[model samples]
Each structure stands twice: as structure tokens, then as C-alpha cells.
Target: MLIFIILALIITILVIKKSKTKLQKTLNETVSNLNKTIREKDDIISELSKYQDIIDVQSKCDELLSNAQNEAELIKKRYETLLTFAQIEAEKIKEKSLSAKKQMDEQIKIRKVEYDNILSTALEQSKQIISDANIKAEEIAGDAYKALNNHKELEQKAKAMKNVIEGYGNKYIIPTHGILDELADDFGYAEAGIELKKSRQKSKFMVENGLAAKCDYVENNRKTTAINFVTDAFNGKVDTILSTVKSTNYGVLKQKITDSYILVNNLGEAFRNAVITPEYLQARLDELKWAVAAFELKEKEKEEQRLIKEQIREEERARRDYEKAIKEAAKEEEMLKKLMAKAQLQLQEANDQQKAEYESKLIDLQKKLQEAEEKNQRALSMAQQTKSGHVYIISNVGSFGEDVYKIGMTRRLDPLDRVKELGDASVPFTFDVHSMIFSDDAPKLETELHKIFNKNQVNKVNPKKEFFKVNIKDVKSQIEKMGIQSKWTMLAEAKEYRESLAIENEMKSSEEFAS
Candidate 1:
């Protein structure tokens, strides 16, 4: 019985030991599984946790990736905005640059235009100034040249004058002065052979050489010519009248207009004063003597007529008887009555014809007188104006006035000399020198004088003793009252006389006048 109990105990110990070992093994497996579970939990928790953790870790990763995608998209949007703004800024810069270039181009065009206008104006002004300067310079030079030439010409003339003065006179120049103007009148030159030359080219060598103006005197009339013609017609028949008169005597030369012998003294005076020189002086005297001899023969016939005048007592009775016999004839009485009536009618016709002729002649005379008066005016003006470096001698001469005397005379001496000479010549103290009546032809003055006065009437004037010397008396009156200093009163008086007799006055006085 003891042994059975030991075997059972052994079996129980063994089973217990095996069970302990298994339980320990299970505990280790549970611990390891728990560790694995915890790790898994951690892992599961971790695995499941891990799977959950993996799921959790995957969720966290997905969240992180989504956030990154959102950030990238934002970056892309910002880049696009930057690019658009940059493009806008660049476009604005380009436009501004183009505007600046356009402005610069416009300024260049304006500057060019202004420069061109300025250049053109400058050129035009320069050209005008040059042309004007050339014209001015040319004028100045021309004037200068003309002045130089004039100076040279003056010098040459002065030199020539000096040389001419050195020459001699007698053969080259005449000593006489009275013939100087006459020579000039004929030669168409002055005494010096030069027209404008005052100092004769010969005068420089020829001292006291000069000339007086030569004037002419003519009787104003038609009867003078007729009387001259009558003397020629009658030859020696009326030599008494011819001896006292001459073809050349001018102005009033007689004391009275009716004086028959007054012409004698006038003819003699004219002969003495006339320029008769040595050449013709002798011939003139001989001619005058022959005229005187013829006059003596004619005077004898008149003396015989005066002596036979007393023996006419019986002749007067006989003349009455003869006249009665003529009246008694029947045929003679009838013819006488018819003739007397015809003569009366003829006388009336003749008177009417004479009136018409006188009117026509008066008109012609007036026109001729006016023309002559104008020529005299010009001549008088020339006389008053004197040439330089020259002395003039003027005279109012001859019996053509009141006396056979010189009315006026002027010398280079003085006024007192002239007065003395006038007093000596029986000229009035108031008488002044008239003009130096200069003429190229002596006949022209003589002709003009005849146109003014009738030759027979001229011879009747007495210059010293007046009977009807109207012209001489008038001259004296003018000198006394008018206080005129000119000796050329003869010319002036004639002009005044003509003007006073205008057509208006003539028409008033006459019954018939030209319209």
C-alpha cells in the first residue's frame, strides 16, 4: 500500500511540472503577443495603429501634398501678373521715345527754314548795296575827272594869254579906237579878234587900244526920199535945194520945219562929224563943193522972178479980156458947165477914196512902228549891260536935235568932264548920255531914223533955237521934270511915242477902223 501511494505522487508532480512549464510558455507567448499587440497597437495601433498609424500617417501626408499643390498654383498666378505689368511699362516707354523723336524733327525743320530765309535776305541786301556803291563811286570819279579837266583848260588859257601879251602891236593891231566896233560888226568878232575876250589878245601888247560903239542915224520919212529922187530927176535944175540936203543926214536938222536953208547947216555939220578919215575925207569935201556950185546957179533964176513982179498993170487988164472972150463962146459955156458938175462929183469920190487910203495907210504904219519899237527895246537893254574890264563912250550928237552940236558925251574921265563938255557944246546941263547905239551896219541905223522922221521935217528942227522943234523941247522937258539919267532918251522917246498911239486910240479918233 505504501508503494502505490508513491507512484501516484510522482505522476502528479510530473503533471504539475508539465503544466507549469506550459503555463509559463503560454505566459511568455501572451507577453510576447501583448508586446506584439501593444507594438502592433502601437504598431497595429502601430500596425492597426501602425495600420491606423499608417492610415493616420497617409492622411497627414495627403494633407501635406494638397497644401503644397495650393502653394504652387498661387506662385504661378503671381508670375503671370508680373509679366503683364512689365509689358505695359515697356509699351509706355516706346511711345514716349517716339514722341520725343517727332518733336526733335519738327525743331530741325523750323531751324532750316529760318536759316534759309536769313541767307536769302542777306544775299539780296548785299547785292543792292554793292550796286549802289558802284554807282556812287562812278559819279564821284566822273565829277573829279571833270574838275581836273577844267582846271587844266584854265591853266592852258592863262598861259596862252601871257604868251600873246609878249607879242608886238603895230603890224598886228590898229591904233584907232573909233573903228573897233565897226571892225567887229564887219568881222563878226571883237577888236581883239575874239568875241568873248574882254582884254583884246592884242591889247596886252597894244596899250591904249580899245573901241567905242558905233551907231547909225536915219531920217524918218518918205518925202525925204522923194525929194532926193526929185533932185536926181532935175539934175542941176534945183541944185540950190540939193546943196543943203544929203541922202544920209538923219533926224531933225533944221531950226524950223518950214526953213528952206536949215538943211544946209545940217548937211555941213554931218559932214564934219562923220567918220571920214584920210581915205575918203578929201573926196567927200570935193563932192560937197560941186553941190554948192550947182545950188548957186539955181538960186539966180529965183532972183530974176522977184525983179519982174512990178510990170504987171497992163498984163492984168489983158488977162481979164482974154478970160471974158473964153466965157462968151456957146460951146465953151455948155462944156464948162458940164465939166464943173462932173468935177464936183469927182471931188466927192476922191475925198472918199482918200479917207479909205488914209485909214489903210495908218493901220500899216502902226504895225511897222510896233515892230521897230521892239527891236529898239532889245538894243537899249544890250547897251545898259556893260562888259567887264571895258569902258564905253556913248553920244547924242548932230543938228538932228536942236543945234549943230553934240547932245551928250561920256569919257572915262568923270561926270564933271561930261558936264564941262556938254556945256561947251550948248547941250542942256540936264542932258544925260543916252546909249551907244551899236550896229553891225551903219545903213540900218540910217534907215531906222528915216522911218521915224521925215527928212525935210528933220532938217527944219533947230536944236539950239527952236521954232517948232517938238522932239528937242520934249527931251529937255523930260530931263528937267522926270529926272531920268539916261542919255538914250531919243530911243526911249520914240518907243513911248509909239506906245501912246495904240490901235484903240486910233479907232476912237477915226470914223473907219479895222474890226
Candidate 2:
């Protein structure tokens, strides 16, 4: 019985131990499954948090896009307003330009009308002059033949011729054997010599009688060639008249113009003995008519000169006035400098107000001194500008012959000394003074005179020659036209030249008789 009970107990114990082992194995498997479940739950929570973050970033991007659209709309509206303003301003500018253009066109038309009126008036005046010339020509033709027929009238004719030829008491006349062209000289002198041979007995008779001077004057003064004489005479007289008309003051210009009309009439009368042909006389008349345009040009030049002189005078006066102001400023500046220096020294002992006053005065004085110095420098620059010089009009008939004069300028105090030097050894005789004009800017005056006679210049190549084949009347006229005050002596008392000419004529007369 004990063995059976022990076996039963062992079996029971084995069964109990097996049940406990099974229970422990089951618990370990459950624990491992629980751990896997926990790990998967944690991964899911981390993925959900990542999705929430993406949602939040998308919301912010959408908000930013909306704000950018709003800003872009604002910028578009602003640009549209600016564009509208620009278009309006552009339209206004276009309208203004067109209006200005129209006004300019209107002014140009007005100027054109004024120019036409001036041209028409000038034409009428020219026609009147031509008519006067024709009437004078008729008078000369009528009086001339009758005068030639009567001996007493011939004496009057001779006196009239002398007055005309010699130019108001032998003033313009040079004691030369006429300023003849080479061809005219060769032909006319030869022809006149032959005629002179025929008139030797008559000349001898006149010499024996008291009519030698008259005969001698006629022979010396008369131009045998008609075309040359009329051309020269008309040119000379017209130039004079033109100069007078252009240069004379308005008060005297009308009288001078009327004198010009009388001059043409007188020219016809004076040259009637020389200019026998109608063709030559017509040419002279035509020349006087053509001279109208020339006169207009000269007047224009004179106006230009007047404007230039006015400008120069204005500049000079401005400079002088400025210089005076600068000197006064300098004087004031000196006074201020001394006052400022005293004030500066006093400032050390003075209070705040006085120190401030001293500094202000010092600054003002420095500014003034600077201005004065600048003005004084400008005055120095102006002082270096064209200084005064002497312009002289002189003639040497023995050297250069009739109607020729020298236009020259010098900076010398005694301009006559220069003239004397010129006449010393280079020329056979001394120079005759027509005038001496002093100018602040002599070069400008000299240049204008040269322009007047550029065509008639003796030495076109050499500016130093300063000689022109122009009459003294022309020179005087040009000078006077320029508003230059000059001491004028019309009498070209060529004493040496006349003596030399007399000696030459005496020798010629002796030779001609002997031959």
C-alpha cells in the first residue's frame, strides 16, 4: 500500500511541475508580443506629427501667395497713374513746341516784309538819281560846245576845268602826268604829243602873252582818253558820295545825299570836255547807279562798325567802372581789415557778443577782399587788351603819283616821327598829311580802312605796303564815316613834287622844241 501511495504522489508532483513550466513559457511569449505592439504604436505617432507639420507649412505658403497678389495689384495701379501723368506732360510739351514754331514763322514773315519795303525804297531812290544824271548830261552837252566856240567862254571853261580837275584849289590834285592806264598812256600821250607839236606856236604865243598858266593847266589836267577819265572820275566821286552818305550824322546826311546828287551833275559838267562820247558818259551814269548797291553795302559795314565800336566801348567802360569799383572795394577792404584786426585783438578782452561781432566782420572783410582781388585781376586782363595807337593818312605824290595814299598805324607818341622816317630816304619827297586819327583800338580802324580799299590796294601781296590807289577824299570819307574825330587838311601842298614837275616840264618843253 505505501509503494502505491508514493507512486501516486510522484505522478501528481510531475503533473503540477509540467503545468507551472507551461504557464511561465506562455508569459514570456505574451511579453515579447506586447513589446512589438508598443514599438509600432510609437512609429505611428511620429508619422502623424510629421503630417501635421506639412499641413502647417502649406497654410503659410498659401497666405504668402495671397499677400503677394495684393501687393502686385497695388504696384500695377501705381504704374498706371504714373503712365497717365507722363502722357499728359508729353502732350503739353508738344503743344508748346508747335505754338513756339508758329510764332517764329510769323516773325520771319514780318522781317521779310520789312526787307522788301527797304529794297523797293532803295530802287526808287536809285531811279531818281539816274534821272538827275540824264538831265545833268543834257545840260553839259549844251553848254560845252558853245563854251568851246567862244574864246572868252573858253577862258571861263578853262577856269571851270581847273577848278574841277584840281579839286577845290589844287587840294586833291597831284603834280603827276595824269594817273593813266598803260595802254591809254601809250596811245593818248603819243597822240597828245603830236597835237602838242601842232600847238607849239600857239603855246609860244600863250607863253609870250599872259595866258601861259591857263594853257599849261589845261594841258596838264585834261585826260585825253574818255573811258578812263569818266570811269576814274565817277568811281572817285561816287566813293566819296557813298562814304558821306553812310558816315554823316542824320541831321547832315540829307544835305550830303543832295550834295551827292549835285556831285553827279558836277561830274558830268566837269568831264564834258574829256568824255565827248555818249557811250562813255552812259557808262559813267550806269556806274553811279551801280554805286547805289555799293553804297548800301558800305552803309551796312559802317553799321556793323558802329555796333562793334559800341560793344568795345561798352566793354571798356565796364572794365574801367569795374576797376574803379575794385579800387574802392580795396580801400574799403583795407579799412575793414584794419578794423577787423583791431576787433580780433579786442575780442580777447571783450565778452561773447563782441567776439561774435568781431568774427562776423572778419568773415565779411575776407569775402570782400576776395571779391576785390578777383575784380583787380579782371582789370589787369582788360588792361592787356588792345591799347591806343595812332592811325595816319598821308600821301606822297612824287613817289606814288595821283590819288594814291598810305594808310598806316603806329603806337608811337609822336606818329609824325614815323612818317618822317618813311619819307626820309625811301621816298624822293616828304609825305603830305591828310589826317591823323587816334584810336583806342587802332588795328580795328586800320582793318576797316583796308577793307574799304582792298580791291585798289597797290601791293595786294604785302600787307605792310598799306598803300591804296584811292583818292584822299575817299580816305577822308571812310575815316569820317567811322565816327573817328581827326584833324583834316584837304590841301596836299606838294611843294617838292610841284617843283620837280615844273623842272621836268621845262626840260620837256626845251627838248620838244629842240627835237
Candidate 3:
């Protein structure tokens, strides 16, 4: 940009210089030619004067020449001054051009530097932006790959599972001290439940497979394992496991077992005893595996006992706090606090009472268990009197018409005794007692059999009694409701009917006294 301006100024100076030179040359040529032409003309005028009135003519010619020379001189002086002014103006123009040219060059240099800086900055930013984009893209791709890998891992795990997905944590296939029944329920089907129970039994309280194999008691343990838990039991060191299931070396696990006593705490004792109970099928249980369950149960029981004591202390403190609150109530305006305290005391007392009731219920349950034990003992003793024969089913329970029958399981437990315990009297003897059709889970079998048999369908034993089934639990629930009536007093007519005219005599006596 500055170069173009400088070129324009130089061109203007050259044009002005050339025009001044041409004007000067033309003026000089014109002046010289005029002087020569005047000289010749002057000679001619002088000669003509000499011919006629020569003297007079020559004098006039000389005067005229003098006048012309004076005019020419004045013109020359004016031209010279004009020429000088022109030269001075040209010099001024040149000086202005040189100053403008210098300024233009400086601006050009500054603009070039700025443009280069801008270009360099833009290049640097572009490189940085590209680098950042590439890094971010790579990170995203890596994350996507990781996600895909995780998904594949999950898919593989799912494929590896033989049956039910153990979405619930599978620390152990079936832990020791844990009930097999609970695990079975989680698996969602009866057969699976049976397998879960079988797993629990195999583990006993849970031990390494090799350790379990060492014991004669667990020789027939049917559980197959992805990881063995019985190897520690063989070495007699189940508490500190530092070795694998297949290895015979008693390292970490052995150390742990030796250091950790099995039967020190109440929970430990409970679980140890549970592993040996016949109900859990201890005879067939892998004692080595049961150790794991025992450990867990012991921990849980310890926590439960600790919480129970804490709650008891809290309740006692609350009760004591309330008892003292009445004394503070005197000479006080805030009856509300006292009232609230009293209410709190009552609530605490009630809670204590509820806890007592629960404990009582536990006692009752214990008593019931004892009774059950006695009954079982009696039944065992009466095994001699027991006979495999037909039993009667002649009665039904409740008004919500359903097939609730009196099912007698052989002749071991008297039908009358069973009926009475069920809170009902047995019906009068009717028809013949039929032959035993089938026997499985008797309670469940009975309910299903009755559902199939339908109403007035006595002595009619169906072949598909085994296949046709009802939930015994549901039947038992219904039966339970029938045997007890919470609102017996609400039925006015039934109440009156049961008592007959006992109210009439009392009414008559009150009326007579009034008269």
C-alpha cells in the first residue's frame, strides 16, 4: 500500500519537472527570435527615414527601439521570477513526496509484521485445537471399547451360569450356618430350592471340597463346585485360609482356623449346633463347608444381641426419665411438657410391655415346641399302636363354603386328637373309611386331593390326586380363620339363640321392681 503512494508522488514530481523545463525552453527561444526580428525591422525603418525626412524618421525609429527594449527587459525579469517560484514549488513537492514515502514504507512494514503475527497465531491455535480434538476422540474411543469389553464380560458370565442367575451376591454357593430353605426361596422354583438346600447340606456349616472329602461323614456330599471350600477342613485349620481348594497344603486357611476358635461365642455355638442338627440333614452335611455359614451366623447373632441390649437400655432410660418428670411438673407453667413426658412414659411402658409380650410369645412358642416334642415323642411311642389303614374325612370348616375336610393321616395320631387340636370337634361317624390312595407331603396332598374330589365326593379317590394339587398353605390359612371368630359377640341373633331366655328373666325382674 505504501509503495503505490510513493510511486504516485514520484510520478507527480517527474511530470512537474518536465513541464517546467519545457516552459523555460519555449520562453528562451521566443525571446531570442523576437530580439533578432526586431533588429532587422529597425534597420528597414532607419533606411526608409533617410529617404524622406530622413533625419526626423531616424530619430523616431531610435526612440521606438529604446521603448521596445525596455518592455522586453521587464517581461524577462517577470518570467525569471515566475520561473524561480515554479522551481521553489517543485522543491516543496519533492520534499512532501519524500516525507510521505517514508511514512508509507513504515506503515507497510508495520502491517507486514502484524499480518505475519496473525498468521502465526492462527496456525498455532489450529494445531492446538486439532491436537485436543484428536486426544478427546481417542479417549472417547477407549471408553467405548471399555464399555464393550465390560458388556462382553457380563454376557460371558450370564452364559456360564447353568440355571438361576445369582444376582444376589454369591460369596459362597451356599454359606454355612445359613438356612438352605432361604436360599431355595431366592432361586424362585421348588426344584431349585431343593438343590439350594442340597447345597447347604453338602456344605454342612461350608468347608473346602478336599477338606470335606477327608471326613467320612461327608463322603457322599453330592454338591459339585466351581471353587472348592472343603480343603481347609481336612487340615483341621478352617479359620485362616490362604490356600486354594485343590491344594493339599495347609497355609493361610489352616492358620486362620487354628487361630479362630469355632465354639467360643453364642452364635458360633448355635451355628455349630445347627450344622449337627438332624432337621438340616447334618448326617449327610459337609462339616467343612458349614464353617463358613457358622462364621456368618455368629457375626449376625452377635450384632442382633448387641442391638437388643441397646434397645433395652434405651427403653429403661426413657422410662426413668419420665418417672422423674412429674416432680419437675410442680410450680411449672408448661403442663404440655409434663403431659408429653407422661405420654412418653406411657409409650415407653407400652413398648416395654410389647417387648415383654413378644418375649412371652417366644416363651409360648418354646412351650409349643416342647408340646410338639412331647407329641412327637408320644407319636414315636405310639408307633407300636399305629396301623396302616384307611381314615375318615367327613367334616368341613367355616361358612365361606370351601372344601376343608377332616383328613386323618393313618391311625398313629388319633383323628379326634387332631380335630380337637385344630379347634373343632370331629363330625359324627359316617360312611366307610377308604383305603390309602397316596401319601406324600400329607398336608399339601390332602388339600389338592380335596379340591379334585369336590363336594359330596366322598370315598371317591381320584387317580390324579398326585398331579392335581392345591396350595396347602392357602388351605391352612382358610382353616385357621374358621377355627377362631374374633366377632362372635357381634352376631346378635346368634348370641341370643345361644343363650335362649336368660335375658328375659332379668328384664322381667327389673320391670317388677319398677312397678
Query: Candidate 1 regions off by >4 Å?
Result: 1-103, 115-515
Q: Please report the TM-score between candidate 2 and the true structure.
A: 0.26
Q: Each model's C-alpha lDDT?
A: 0.42, 0.64, 0.45
At residue 256, candidate 3 shows an lDDT of 30
Off by over 4 Å in 2: 1-386, 508-515
lDDT digits (tens) for residues 34-126 of candidate 1: 887676555434334335667788999999999999999999899899989989998999999899899999999999999999999999999
Model 3 Cα shift for residue 357 (angstroms): 68
What does the lDDT come to for candidate 3?
0.45
Q: In candidate 2, what residue range of length 10 has the lowest lDDT sum? A: 174-183
> Could you tell me how far off, in angstroms, the CA of residue 262 lies in candidate 3 after the best superposition?
28
Q: Work out the TM-score per prediction.
A: 0.15, 0.26, 0.18
* Candidate rank order under lDDT: 2, 3, 1
What lDDT does candidate 3 reach at residue 24?
Answer: 90
Model 3: per-residue Cα lDDT over 1-515, one tens digit each = 88999999999999999999999999999999999999999999987876777777799999999999999999999999999999999999999999999999999999999999999999999999988976787688977755665685445444334212432233223322234334433333344434436665555543433323321232244322211323323223332232232322222233233222222211222222211122222322333333333333444456667866864654344344333333332223244344445555555667655656555544554555455445544444433332322233423222112333334443323344333343333432221221232232344545554564454343332322122123334434544454521111111122222343467777899999999
Score candidate 1 by lDDT. Answer: 0.42
